[model samples]
Target: MSWRIHHVSLPTRDVRETAEFYTEVLGMAESSPPWKDQDRGEFDIDLAHVAWFQGENAQVHLSRHSRNFARDNNFHLDPIINGHVAIEVDDLDAVRERLRRKGVYFADPGNWALSGLDQIYVLDPALNAVEINSQLK
Candidate 1:
């Protein structure tokens, strides 16, 4: 079957914060009304509600916590020690500084540069890793 990946859902403790992270830190555009319709609740999906944000090439759907879940469901959601989402930017340092000023903690000031690219890794409010990189000449 032919298919296109319109969006990718990222689970977070706070949908609003996650949406802001994508928009403010990564430069993604938050959708108006900030509401999205998904077939999740109908099929008893794992998420509560999803918010949509537009990136340069693709769209991102931020999943929020639902009432169906219980407090002991920690195992189902653990952002730390897991792989992160990487995004490319024109100015890595500037983005890094912006995130820092927003009280974000970067794993390092700047990681190694390879193949003419500068990189810095950071985490969102939910502890999801975010790699911000720049294409260097």
Candidate 2:
């Protein structure tokens, strides 16, 4: 399946500062998050604590760290605990099938963060969380 780095998420204590640093200092333009107006459903994220920056090919997501967000939401793998690299795959089902065959446990959050994204989380060998997602048609 075709795969590409969609975005890299970073946890910060202050979302506005981090966003300013990325935009003013790093020269990345601020981008609107897809979930801006959409309800998070059960994800329970504060939009005020999040920001997005656009790169040439990929994006950067900054979020305020919250220890309770994952546990409160009952997520097996916390996408923002530390941070995560989001990979966009051409076929999400194919990736899920491969993970199942390999006995890799994945947490399907299913578009909780972004609209039209079918997302799942997996831990890498180093125990770092990784997000695999595909755009829904």
Candidate 3:
């Protein structure tokens, strides 16, 4: 299974302002379908306000800061960081099996509320969260 660094996430108090900054100052363009959406029960989350910015190499996800999204292993590593690193994978099942064989633990190869992109969260040795998204095949 091939893995690629997809994007980096950051938590912000003001998603619009942050998005604009990334676009205007950093030259990152706003990604299409900038909002997160979901059915009532596809996942359990507070329906955070978020946006995405696209750079040359990777995308940037901006989520609004909130205490409920915090986790012990969150890369600082909870929702507290600028955000988490996302890895896009070709074979999620193979990757999961490999991680299992190596005794690595993870959570939620789950879909996003709006995008329906499947992802799983894992922590590094340093407790930094790494998000692995599926190819949806």
Candidate 4:
């Protein structure tokens, strides 16, 4: 069976800020405009674009934590949880430098693994962990 990852949800307190973080800071291409489905009338859904590069088939869906859902479902993860979204970049160093110049601080500075790829980990405006690596495969 052939399976593909259509999307992954990233819960954020602010949708616009988080969406812009993925697009502007990480250099991810906006796949499409924000999607709003009225069928799910319980809450307003604002889905931003996604970025899938190389063999990595994944998209980041910025989900607004609805108060209604939280009230009814009573399911929520603490914002400080050690959660992250990883993105592979072609020019890791160049991107890292660009982000740094833009006031994005990296948690791991030039600390790479055996994949022979450099990785820079940072947090988005919503405090969501964002990883930029050179290894996509």
Candidate 5:
């Protein structure tokens, strides 16, 4: 399956400040999050606590850390805990099956963060979280 880096999420105490740094200092344009107006009933995160910035083909997501959200959702892999790099794959199911065959533990959170996108989180050897996702057909 083909895959590419979709975005890099960074946890921050202040989303606005971090967003400003990315946009003003880094010359990245502010981008609207796809889940901004969607009904995030399944996720406990508040939209106000997040920001998005775009740089060419990839994006940077700034999120205010919410430990309660992860704990409440009982997510095995917390995507926002220390931040994560998202990879968009052509076939999410294929990737999932591969992970299963490799005996890699991953958290399947589906579309908890964005509409029309199925997402799963896994950890690298260094214990850094990585998000694998695909656009829903």
Candidate 6:
């Protein structure tokens, strides 16, 4: 499956401040709606607030916290990292099958709390969290 960059998500202590920094220093403008809360139970995550900043070609998501974060993710560790990048693909089913067959290690694809896109979490070799999302048609 051909992969295209979607966005990068960063877990920060303060979402507003992080967005401000990106907007003021990096010149990223708020692309999506204002920050809001999330209500999903996947990966033991309960995001309180999230915001997205738009750059010239990509997007950045900032979140305050995730309650009950994943404890046994691919790296067998809680996602204590930042700048989690995302990739979008049209054929999610094929990608899932390929990843499963190769034993590449990934999570079950599920709809996000607010954004109903189907997404799966996969960790890179360095244990960096990567979100693979798709809005299946």
The prediction achieving the highest TM-score against the true structure is 2
Q: Which lDDT tens digits does candidate 5 get at residues 6-119?
A: 999999998888878877898878776777235644443454688887777788888887768667777876788799999999999999999999999999978767768899
Model 1 TM-score is: 0.38
- Please, what are the lDDT tens digits per residue for candidate 1 over residues 2-112? 223333446777767776777789877767322222223222223234456676665666666455443333233332234346576766667867877998666542434
TM-score of 2: 0.88
What's the distance in Å from true for residue 17, model 5?
1.5
Better of 1 and 5 by lDDT: 5
Q: For each candidate, what is the lDDT? A: 0.53, 0.84, 0.67, 0.52, 0.83, 0.66
Each model's TM-score? 0.38, 0.88, 0.71, 0.38, 0.86, 0.71
59: Cα error in model 2, Å: 1.0
Candidate 4, which ten residues in sequence have the lowest lDDT sum? 46-55
lDDT of 3 by residue, 1-137 (tens): 57788788887888888778887998776765433353444433333467766777678778786665545223233533547788888877787788899998777636643364677778888788788886555
- Would you list the clashing residue pairs of candidate 4? none
Question: Best lDDT goes to which candidate?
Answer: 2
lDDT of 6 at 96: 83
* C-alpha lDDT (0 to 100) for residue 18 of candidate 6: 78
Question: Lowest-lDDT window of 10 residues in candidate 1?
Answer: 34-43
Supply candidate 5's per-residue lDDT for 30. 79
> Every model's Cα RMSD, please?
13.7, 2.2, 4.5, 13.9, 2.3, 4.6
Candidate 5: the clashing residue pairs are none
* TM-score, structure 6 vs. true: 0.71
**lDDT score at residue 128, model 4, on the 0-100 scale:** 77
In candidate 2, the residue pairs with backbone N, CA or C atoms under 3 Å apart (3 or more residues apart, or in different chains) clash, namely none
**lDDT: which is higher, 3 or 6?**
3
Summing lDDT over every window of 10 consecutive residues in candidate 6, give the lowest-scoring window: 34-43
